[model samples]
Target: MDFRTQTSSLDALSGVNADALVLVLAGDTLPVGLDASVAAAAKDAIKLGDFELKAGKTLVLPRVAGLKAPRLVLACAGKASLKSARSAVQSALSALKSGGTVHAALAFAGFDSLSEALVEQTVLAALEVSYVYRHTKPSAPAAPKLAKLSLLLGKDDAKAAKAGLARGQAIGAGIELAREAANRPPNYATPTFLAEQVKALGKSHGLKVEVLDQKAVEKLGMGSFLAVAKGSTEPLRFIVARYEGAAKTVAPVVLVGKGITFDSGGISLKPGAGMDEMKFDMGGAASVLGTLRAVAELKPKLNLVAIIAACENMPAGNAVKPGDVVTSMSGQTIEILNTDAEGRLILCDALSYAERFKPAVVVDVATLTGACVIALGGVRSGMYASDDELAGALLAAGDAALDPCWRMPLDDEYEEGLKSNFADVANVAGREGGSITAAKFLQRFASKYRWAHLDIAGTAWKSGGAKGGTGRPVGLLTHFLLSQVR
Candidate 1:
């Protein structure tokens, strides 16, 4: 579909002359069809509520014979308000999305006026949100469908609005690309493969990128992350992406992502059923990498440090077993009571190591536990934080980005879930209130710095193939980073 801006209602006439839908704002009766008499009759029909036209309502008119009224559709924008106008456009778009087959155009209300940027941003947001991807397991190639979209704005307004849409669409395309990466199969999206993918994205976007292999991970004392990777023949991978768009003196915002590319419950060993979906376990890291790609392209005036602790967690002879104690970079020992509780093990060292970068703030994302999914369901992710102000900022950013998240509790009472007799903490507690305990474990590693943990277990990937790739809260990570700039 070609979603472009049209300057005036007259520009729409040059396009395909099929049945068209022109959304008009209702006010005092307006002329419709070819003759003034015909327009008067149409007005009478509207007065009689034949088409059921009302303020802030949508009325679809059948084929007629006027330049703009032949297939005229009236969508009420109450009293020429900006919000109402935007609502009307969105309603029309929703109508189109829900199966309206018309060359769509929004015929402007000649009396009302709006800024080009506002119009462009509104339309752009609508178009981006309305894009529905159709992907099925049994794939078939077919011809495309045509559902053209046009906005009739003033000449100057059209140019500015289209430019705004162009910019927004570019960023959205990057986001969609990352979402697809997050949706790929486990075998196809291994740690090494993702490392290469991030390297490619970094190079293209003019950001600095580096990857540390298994040997490097061991050398850097990433014991917890390495323990999980020990069972898989596939090399463990750790990636760092840096975006420098501010002055050298500015402190950077750091993003840490748990990239367990494929988790099979390690030595604890997951059940045989539904393990294939572990592919999307790396969604958090993919979102972080995607944010780097977008920030570099958008050239936001900020400094960023993105880290992906990428590895595969499988059950093999070499895998770390239960009751094993491992010392992290922070010199804190953790007892591995259940190897399935491994994401925090990997992320703990990652979060502690981030201290070297001297960041003003740090945020970590992970699909850490099913407990989070049990608590929040699939629509919203669980948010845990050590700082009240940072949590507030994140909540606001999530709302602004339309990547909804709910602040989950991180009470001190849950701290006992991680206490161990010998080590500093145990990997897992009993099944009761598991999500809060897992968060409590990660909180121990984020001392001093303002940090937030996003548990994306529920929102990372859907079970029965949702229409879109990836999920919400993925964008929230990027949105949070962008919000932190000065």
Candidate 2:
């Protein structure tokens, strides 16, 4: 959608030509800046108990006397805060979905002034509510008609609001790209398919894209990654994409993603129920591509490299079985105690491969463990970092982007759970603290540099009515990368 900033004044509102006007109120009393007739209409509605000043409440007026817009929507934010503003925008947009409105002007009342945080959150919420998945489902309803959005702000806040709109648009596009790839079925979004998507993104953004086939991966001694690909008939692809906005000598921020496109638990098959959701196993890989797209669009003055170990984990005759020991690119041995724990196996080699970039920091994203879902639920992604500084930066970034993550303990004691009887380490530990053990397994290969892991199994997608990819952590990752820009 096209977004721009407009002056939120009485004269400006008089000339504003949109199908609908959204007035975000911070309290019960109307602010002094709204158009006289529009404010009177809203005040009358509140007095008659037609609308309450509760958070996320909405009231629609078919026509306001003096406004150029045909419809007026009064949305309650309850208080002046970024979170409330976002919810108010979302609530207003949700109410307009079935209408014929094509453009909406959003003006905040009773707030101090429009800030970058407010505008950015507003745009992000609009884009998120506008998303509709219709790629595979031909009979799905068409998306909403609302196509253009205007954020009404004062003249002093125009510059900052414009910047926020740009960032929001870039990040929103990235989220859409991630959700599209993740929502596709396994047959349509295979390892090769993902490599093709990366190449396309690279060509458009002037990035250096490389896809390592099975032979090249084997040449690099990625036995651990190859083991996960053995069961699938489709070929495996290791993707490396580079965005160089700075000097080549600069140490780049490396992002490694686990790309198990369709995980069937390999020789250890998962239960039949809800197996279709396994297509979302590549959510980490999707988010990596999404963040790269956003960073490339913004042209941050920092070098970035993305590494994806794309493959499928299936239960076939030649699939890697439990009790098998595999050697990784780092020369570390891992015992396959449970093939379902394959995300870490592929990521170990990918993290080891990231060392060649001489990275300043490496953060690997993966839908790693179900135990993480039980621990943190869907509210936060499970984060495990080697140092406090890196963890704090990520936590702050998540907070700034409204995509939150909680740091989990990584004490040396957790390593004991991953002890192996024969190999250097076991891929799977006991059921207790399964997520921490999974992070500890990946930590073994990231010893060469500062590293962190995001276990996104619980936050990547939803299961019930909203059974689709949420495109999570893309915002968090984009914010984190932008924070590193110099």
Candidate 3:
């Protein structure tokens, strides 16, 4: 979509002879000048004629008095209520997609002082909602269609607004990358293939990317991450990407993602039911790489790093067995009581290794626990943080991105659930509070820094592809990192 700035009235814009012109009305509104053309001069006693427009409503006006365009779209901007304007914008976008070529003009004449950020967000929402991805499916519903987008600002203060559009496009592209990765069959999106994807993303975005093949990961003592890959012919990979765009003195913000390109549950086999969705086990990695793409394009004044522990867990002669004890790089020993609880196992080593950077903050996102899905359903991801500030920041960032999140507790008592008779901790705690125990397991390695964990099991992939991949934490995480730098 293209966004252009216009500084003219509706009447003056009639000469452009464009496809369509969208007029946005702000407030408890009424639609006026519907039948009139751009060439028609305003009359002193024109009748509004019960054309009262409601807040958060949109009406299409066809062929006004003197304009060459075939139709005129009037969108409502709801009362200057908190976040109501955003809902109004979303509604407008939905309406705009129904019409053919979109060239919109939002003239906020009577609204109270509106922030530039709000405008940017509104515009971003419109263009974003206009897209649909249904190419491969045979019976996919036709997504909404639009060719171009134009925003007629009430004021000529759109200099800061362009960043929002750019960020939105980058984020959308990142989401597509993740969706494509998720859409691929497990045989194709192997550990090696995922590693290559990360490297290509890095090269395109100016990030320094590195892939540690199996030998290198073993050398780093990534026993648990490597163990998951032993059963697959595809080799394991520890992918790292660094973006040093901040001051030399600043420590990087580390993001560790669990990348099980495909999970077969190894010796601790999973039920046959719903195993097909295991392909999305790598959603966390996709999100991390996608956010990196956005951060690279935005180039916020902060150093960023992404560590993805990539592998596939399949039952084979060499696969790590249950009751195996693996020592993480941090010297912590974990008893693998259940092979299915492998995400935390891989993340443990990645988290420990992230400590080498002495980062300002460390956050790890994973499709870690089914318990999280039970707790939050598929709408939101469960957030567990060791620090109050990081947790608060994540919730606030989530609000800004319109992807809401709820904070979950990480009580020290849950650590007891992970107690192991033979090792320092057990990979799988009992059934109770499984999500909290998983968070506590990861918290062990992140005890040194302000850290947060996002268990994205419920939010990564949707049953209805039309809902689109929730693409959850990436938007919130990217916004949070941007806030840190600004």
- Top-lDDT candidate index: 2
lDDT of each: 0.72, 0.91, 0.75
- Candidate 3's C-alpha runs over 4 A off are 9-17, 23-27, 31-61, 66-68, 75-91, 94-99, 102-114, 130-145, 465-468
Which regions in candidate 2 have their CA more than 4 angstroms from the true location? 10-14
TM-score of each: 0.80, 0.98, 0.87
Measured by TM-score, the strongest candidate is 2
Q: Considering TM-score, which of the candidate structures 1 and 3 is the better prediction for this target?
A: 3
Error of 3 at 234 (Å): 1.8
Better of 1 and 2 by TM-score: 2
lDDT head-to-head 1 vs 3, winner: 3
Q: What is the C-alpha RMSD of each candidate to the true structure, in Å?
A: 5.1, 1.2, 4.0
- Residue 248 CA displacement from its true place in model 3, Å: 2.5
